[model samples]
Target: MEDSYRHKGMRRQLVKVVRSKGIKDERVLDAIGKIPRHFFFENALVEHAYQDKAFPIGAGQTISQPYTVAFQTELLNVKPGDKVLEIGTGSGYQSIVLLELGAEVYTIEYQKELYERTRFALPEMGYKANFFFGDGSLGLPRFAPYDKIIVTAGAPTVPDALIDQLKVNGCLVIPVGNAKTQQMLRLTRLEGNKLRKEVFHDFKFVPLLGDDGWKK
Candidate 1:
């Protein structure tokens, strides 16, 4: 549970691995180095925390792999004080990264257990984010028009509500595809409700579930 020197050293090595994999953003690399990923796992699995792979975080959800996290975050192009809406809080790892990068994050989780668990866990680690439990696909309308939005789970298609919630100049990063694999997409809202879309490489993620996502 303790973040000792050895754990910090391991995180440094993990940062190096992520860097070598072409995560050129220095701020993203630094956040990866600073966050104690081990703190998010059970003590028995803590040794594997620094690995680039994903691990089960209870509730059938897995914390995303490090490279995927870096890649998605880099695509987000986060800036300090940006109001970011994150779908799928999961282990709260990604939210912590955004918070570390000076973002004001509002995150939602569909699974009640995961939401409750992460809601408390994050603040305990000195990280803070507005946490909510609901259908993430609907987007948080109360806090709509976010400066940036990131969806952590894979959706069959980008939710229309998410696009509607984005600010005119805001960006949305999501993974879209079928159950098996997804293509990463970045959507930038332009004038006249138009959006500029860009596609990145493929990734695998748990299916996004909600009214706008996969049916229960």
Candidate 2:
């Protein structure tokens, strides 16, 4: 809960590292620099918080590496007041980043433990977002037509439900491939509801669990 001067300094360095990795969005970099990444880590793992690495949180999930978070956020192209749906909330670090970028975030998690923990923990740290517990790969249809969507876990394929929930011209950023390696993909919902897909770098993530994802 405490972010010291040293932590701020470390986050600055982490932002620089993310920038060097080709994350060109200054808004994303600013959010990375401003948030205290260590707050998402256990006391014992605080030393690894700003090292541009993913660390296990619990329930076989991870607080994504800073670079990965920044990469996805940049691809999301969040605009102020944009409605964003976040899948696999995990440690809630990425939600905080979207909030910092002035997005209205609706985040869902598949694990009950992580959902409950982050729901309480984030607001305690003065960050707020709509939190939901369910199968995130199915998408939060109750609040469909989001301006942007981000999936933090790897899926065997893009979930049709998520694409269906995006507003026309909305963007969905997700990793699609196998359980161990996924190619990051950005799918934009075009005017006719057709999708324009762009593939990016490969990454490894915990499998996204739900009906539309890997079987739990």
* TM-scores for all predictions: 0.99, 0.98
For model 1, residues 28-80, the per-residue Cα lDDT tens digits are: 99999999999888788888999999988888799999999999999999999
lDDT of candidate 1 at residue 10, scale 0 to 100: 98
Model 1's number of clashes is 0
RMSD of 1: 0.7
Least well predicted 10-residue stretch by lDDT in candidate 1: 39-48
Task: List CA RMSD, all candidates.
Answer: 0.7, 0.8
Clashing pairs in 1: none
Model 2: which ten-residue window has the lowest total lDDT? Answer: 37-46
| Candidate with maximal lDDT | 1
